[model samples]
Target: MGIGEHVGRNLVTKSKWTSVANVQYRTRRAGQPFPTAGQLSTRLITEAKRTAERSWLGEVSAVVLQQSLRDAETAYRTFFASLKGTRKGPKLGAPRFKSRKDARQSIRFTANARWNITGSGRLNLPKIGAVKVKWSRALPTAPTSVTVIKDAAGRFFASFVIDTDPAADATRMPETHCTIGIDLGLTHFAVLSTGEKIDSPRFLRRAERKLKKAQRERPASRRDRRTGPRPA
Candidate 1:
């Protein structure tokens, strides 16, 4: 699963823990949001099935899935803890799965989807109410997860991970449109391709004397060695 990192602000919200607990309870009762570990295992199973079919390798077993889930949970917890004392880190909250798909290479799930929405487009979350996303680009395949990131600049962005086949026409064409050469000299700023010369304004030369005078006239202090005093 591929993991995409989006950095932005305006996607964070302030919801009380009690309210979130109520929502979780309702979602569990309704079978909306799957448990985090369950979601991870399901995704891993899908990956193993795909790998086994495509490659010479066989399908992965529950052992691999368990280990992967453990590693992921540990990483998640560590990351969450590290966010403490950070200027704009999200508060402690239960992680929610956004989607499930294999995109680039790894499987990713969107965590904190509710708190990571922006703009006015409807975000169809599992159990929580629909949120408004900024609706940038649709994923090539379905996104396994979305990570809402907030940058120091106070911007909010939603990152989606979608597995897709490599593009066939991926080569870039060489530039063949324009060829221009210019020469620069002290007398003239630039001589363009068409042989037009541009003059350079020497602003520093004009202000040199005044700047030198200002620097010279600035206050100077002398230290008396005996008293360890400064005389202005």
Candidate 2:
């Protein structure tokens, strides 16, 4: 978890945005005009920037604070689009206050945030400094943005947005077959149209068998403890 200039066990900026979103929602329901695009861009984010300049919020990157409002803008747009039936997916209700106990919390940073990878192969965030990471794979291109997320298990994750390389993408394509059908099942992992049945590794059953064997092969002292010392 990262909070502004520090990588720690808190999400201060996300918590603040939740409060801002909740206030906007409640006021709207109380007959106030919903925020206009002009207001979102000019007023809300501007106020946030100003607040950062004069307060502890300054520890957060200016772009990070700005991006939070951009997210709020998108949320309100999606909500109204759903209300007007223009959005394709299921209807969306008004933006709700994010729960502190939510299993996941996330914040995004754009190119303007000035984040980069250090020469020593660590993620260098604008305010939080360089952080070590285990690379899943090398990035194909320079990332345009990054999102930092904290999960309920106290693990932090960073996701990067990068442009796709057409040349590299073509290299990954498998040779084309006309078509292949695959049916997934329990006993077998999958059955393919080419008559290939991939056997499922019954890991759970294997573990259970091993556990039962361990229990049955227990020492005499363990057996004695279970049967109340053989009635003596």
Among these predictions, the greatest TM-score belongs to 2
Model 1 residue runs over 4 Å out of place are 1-121, 152-155, 167-232
Clashes of each: 15, 0
lDDT of 1 by residue, 9-100 (tens): 00111111223334544676677652354554454344544674423112222332343455445544544465554435556554443222
Q: Residues 1-232, candidate 2, lDDT per residue (tens digit)? A: 2442332212444445556666766787678776644455454445555774435555667676667656766887788789889999899887665556778777777888788899888998877778899889998789999988877766788899999978888888876869989999988999999999999998789978998998899876546465444632
Worst 10 contiguous positions by lDDT, candidate 2: 1-10
TM-score of each: 0.25, 0.66
Best by lDDT: 2
Given candidate 2, what's the lDDT at residue 213? Answer: 97
